[model samples]
Target: MIGPAALTLLLGLWGVTREHSMWRDEAATWEAAHRALPELAHMLDRIDVVHGVYYLFMHGVFAVLGDSLIALRLPSVLAMAGAAAATAATARRLAGSRAGVAAGTAFALMPSTQHYAQEGRSYALVVAAVAVATLILVTLVDGRGKPGVPARRWAGYAAGMLAAALLNWFSLLALPAHAAAVFMAHRRGATRLLTRWPMAAAAVVAGALPLILASRSQAQQVAWIRPLTWSTALAPLLLLTVGLLCADLLKRLPATPPTPRALSAVSLGLPLLAFPLLALLLLSLIKPLYIDRYVLYTNLGLGLLIGAAASALVRSWRPLVTLALAAFAALLPLQLDLRTPQSRVDDVLAPAEVVARTSRPGDGVLFIPSLRRDTAEVSPGSFTALDDLALAQSPSASGTLQGKETAPQHIRRAMLGKHRILVVADVDGHPGSARDTVKRRVLVEHFTRCADTEVRGRRVQSYERGTSCTAPPLRS
Candidate 1:
């Protein structure tokens, strides 16, 4: 357990700062965490209530650590380390000491696990909580028919589940997976587990109900998620294929001394790996909410199965060590790539750099679609020289991730009054609101593009007022 946790921590800390760049999502976290408590609460009341718990936790982290990028991300690194340890402990109890080490090591090395471990988001914390919950469930199942099992074990499971759910509501999907494990245990004459599991599960639901209700009104926050397609299945299918192959390899080996049916790696790991993912995929068919990060704890199951298979191989073949080394060699490029700023969708600092290099004092700035304001929010020093032409209220004052903007007519007047303006927008521009249409139309008709640069997924351009209006109007 210690070995895997230590390995995970080392991997997470290797490139924790990503060249001092933050993507838009991490920028969102930074913006929210830095806000005053009342402002953060107000922002949650209006948007991102889904992340309210995580943002609140980060608010406290920043309060103590002084809001550095490392402070923003270190909690996730530590959480993932805890997850690695918990995965090891759970595998050890069900399999053996060797299997525990193998499982924890496998989990620490997985690309998905490593990716979230370094992110400044709730997903890593959610994984840690769910991993701990699984460990507790395994303990309870193992202790069935024993005289000294305490109620606190169930309480611990409930608390873990509730924490996971509050961090991200989609974590509730783990309940069905847990249900499958408990059902399998009950079928093997552990009937009392059927009753006890429901009580714990009910507690989780009741505890999470308030967040669920609050987040329902913020549904549009995820409107950007497209409906599912065949491509969506490719990643999960690949992971499932590898896991099943591992399971098959274990099956081919001489069976170790019989364990409880429920404790078998196949029985527990298969359901844990498949159920939540399948449930989410199916749910996405109704409403497109299936993102792999939401169910990252499934990696725990995959790690357990792989570890068991690796343990069997080590016992049966001397070349197993060579194979492990070769596997790491093959994954080296991807591991390194995941540490770079380009690994993320967009680097908020890149555009901010462009703005800082090109703009002068009193130059106006515009964020097409408005949310690109995150770049400025993330690196305010770079933007301090320019005026935000459209902003009517600051993000904190407006209780928004992006500040509220002035009226469309007022925005157009503000733009026209400036001699030079810097525009920060998406590479493929969004169809924006009437206000955005006004900003675009005025820029295209009245301003000449003096310079333009694309960095990562964002575009930053400098515009100067032209002598004559000749360009066609921009589409909304």
Candidate 2:
């Protein structure tokens, strides 16, 4: 457990800063965490209430660490490490020490685990909480019918489940998987678990009910998610395929005499790996919420299945060593790429640097679609000297991301008044709203594009009011 945790921590710390870059999501975290407590609470009341607890926790992190990139991501690294340790402990309890070591090592090497371990988000912490809860569940099942099972174990299990669900409501998907595990254990003679598990699950539901209800009203925040397509399922399908293969391999191994409390790896691992993912996929048929990151904790089950297969081969050391090396070599490229800035959708700092270089004092700034205002909010130093022509209120004050923008006519009037305007926009120029369409019309009709440059996933343009428009309207 210690070895795997150390390895995960070292991998996370290797390129923790991602070359000093942040993407839009992390920028959101930074903006929210730096706000005053009252401002954060106000923002949550209107938007992103799903992340209210995470934001408050990060608020404390930034307050103590003074808001460096390392500070932003370190908690995730530590949480992932803790998750690896807990996963190892769970595997050891089910199988053996060899299985535990193999499981933890496999977890640290998984691309999904490595990716989220360095991110500034709640997913890793949720994974850790779920891992701990699953471990406690295993312990409770093992102790069933023994003299006086400790109540604190149930309390810890409830607390862990509550923590995971509060961090992300989708984590409730874990409950059905836990139920399946408990049922399987009950069939294996742990009959008392059938009664107690429901009590713990009910407590978790009671604790998480408020957050689930509050976040539902803010459903529009996830309105951008499109219905799941074939491409969306490809990665998860591949992972499930691998986990199934490992489970099959475990079945073919020579059966050792079962212990009194022993549960088959397939019972726990298959439910953990398959249940949450299947639930989300089925739900996505009605609404598009099946993002891979939302159920990242499912990877722990994959690790356990793979570890159990590796444990079966441990008697023949050469096969285990060869397989481990082959797996590492296969994953090396992805591990390296995860540390680069391009791994994310957009590099927020790249456009901020362009803004710093191109803007002059008193120059007006505009963000097409307005949400691009996140770039300015994240790196305010680059944008402080320029005037924001469309903003009617600040994000913190407005209790919304990107702030509130005035009416289309008011935005057009403001743009017409500025001699020079700096525009930070998306490269593809997604047709956003009627208001953004008006910004493009005014720019094309009245301003000449003097400079244009494209960064990672954004375009930075400079325009000046002139006698005739010299360049075409922004691309759409």
Candidate 3:
């Protein structure tokens, strides 16, 4: 049991946790957690309502430990370690010991698992909680030939559900899957357990109502998500395939159906991986709410499927499975790639470095639509002398995940006062809205573009009041 978790911790710690740069979401967490507690509470009122619990938890970590890359993300690393251990215990309870060990090992090697294992956000913790809850549920339901469960185990299951739900509100979506797990775990006559379990789950849901209601107003956070597409839709299909494979394999023995425990494990894991994803996909067709990471906890079941399948495969050709696992564990190239800063879509490092070096004293930096203020996330001190021209209130004071926007009149005044202005914007080779429209109109109408450089996710341009386009461009 400990071997699997130890190996998992070693893998998670090697390069990724300490080496990779914080991506946008993690940067968001960094910004949220670094604020004063009162300000953080206010910020949660308007934005990141769904993540309030996690942000608050990290806030404590920041308060006590002080902020650094390691300090920020160490919680997630530990969470993933817990997730791996719980997965092993769940697999052990359901299948045999080999399957338990295999599941934990597979989880550690999974790319998605590794990605969140070091992430600063709450996803790793969410997965860990969900997995632990499943393990307890399996233990609750796997009492074959026994009539009633102990009162303490029932309390544990309810508490687990509450923690899982609070960790990430979307995790409540897994309740139906857990309902299926309960039903499948006791395929015969266990009406009492089934009845009692859902009542406990309901209590958990009831406990989570305040968060659900609060976060409903923050739905705009996901407004950028378009309805589901075929490409994004392949994932659930693949998971269902795994579930089907498990089902197919379970039916193979001619002399006998699988024992109650084997049946329970397969039943719990299959739905655990497949059902919620299918629901999310279907719901996404209606609302476009599907992000692979949103339901990241589902990977718990994926690891189980892989382990169970691998165990089945290993029985036939033990050498093949052993070689594959060994190769995966030793694959230095893949691990290194995962650890690189470039692994993220918009690594803040390059753009931030360019701005730090190029920006001079008394420069005015403006973020179009005002969200790119986060470009300073890694090198905040680099911009300490520069004015953030469009911000009305700081992210902390405004109670916003992103900083508040200044009125157009105020922004125009700020632009007019600055001799040199730097715009770090999402130019994406496109025009702007009323806010950007105001900034662009003021800058181009009054100043000359001294220089403009494109960075990964943004455009950085410097404008001067009287310079000409034909004039020699200043150093970038």
Q: Compare the candidates by lDDT and give the number of the best one.
A: 2
- Candidates sorted by TM-score, descending order? 2, 1, 3
* Number of residue pairs clashing in candidate 2, backbone atoms closer than 3 angstroms, sequence gap of 3 or more or interchain: 0
Residue lDDT tens for model 2, 118-186? 899999999999999989988988886355888999999999999999999798899998899889888
Name the better of 1 and 3 by lDDT. 1
> Residue 57 in candidate 2 has what lDDT?
97
Candidate 2: which stretches are off by over 4 Å? 145-147, 256-260, 316-322, 467-476
TM-score against truth, every candidate: 0.95, 0.96, 0.91
Candidate 3 ranges with C-alpha deviation above 4 Å: 17-20, 144-148, 189-191, 253-259, 316-334, 427-432, 469-476
- Give Cα-based local distance difference scores for all models: 0.87, 0.88, 0.76
How many pairs collide in each candidate, listed in order?
0, 0, 1
lDDT of 3 by residue, 317-350 (tens): 3663575568586866777777876567665545
